[model samples]
Target: MSFLCLHFTRNIHIHAFYLKFSRILSTQNAYLNRFVVSLRPLNN
Candidate 1:
């Protein structure tokens, strides 16, 4: 029973960490997309 509880909590922690990491990645991706779009006109 105790092991099950530990496993559940560990999964939750990992999931939360993954969510945070993904959010940051998506934000950076958006910034990169905007930066690329701004540079496109210059290349033309």
Candidate 2:
């Protein structure tokens, strides 16, 4: 029973970590996209 509880808590922690990491990744992607768009005129 204790092992089951530990496993459950670990799953929750991993889920939360993934959510946070994904959010950061999405924001970084947006920033990179904007940066690339800004450079378009210079490249032309």
Candidate 3:
């Protein structure tokens, strides 16, 4: 029973961590897109 609880909690932790990591990745992607867009004016 205790083992099951532990496993469940671990799953939740991993899920939260993954969500946070993905959010960071998305924000970084947005920044990179903005940077690329800004550079386009100079490129042409």
Candidate 4:
């Protein structure tokens, strides 16, 4: 029925959003890690 179709569509949208967020989060984490490493002194 129409309700079932709507539910399916909503679920797909939420899943896609989560996937995109995860990708962005991973990229952000990598950038932060590099920044942290750069902050450390070479002698340490």
RMSD of each: 0.4, 0.5, 0.6, 1.7
Candidate 3 wrongly placed segments (more than 4 Å): none
2-32, model 3: which lDDT tens digit per residue?
A: 9999999999999999999999999999999
Candidate 2 deviant stretches above 4 angstroms: none
Query: On residues 1-44, what C-alpha lDDT tens digit does candidate 1 reach at each position?
Result: 99999999999999999999999999999999999999999999
- For each candidate, what TM-score against the reference? 0.96, 0.95, 0.94, 0.85
TM-score of 3: 0.94
Question: Which lDDT tens digits does candidate 2 get at residues 1-44?
Answer: 99999999999999999999999999999999999999999999
After aligning candidate 4 to the native by TM-score, how far in Å is the CA of 24 from where it should be?
0.6
Per-residue CA lDDT of candidate 4, range 5-31, in tens?
A: 999999999999999999999999999
When 3 and 4 are scored with TM-score, the better candidate is: 3
Instruction: Name the candidate, 1 or 4, with the larger lDDT value.
Output: 1
Residue range with the least summed lDDT across 10 consecutive positions in model 4 = 35-44
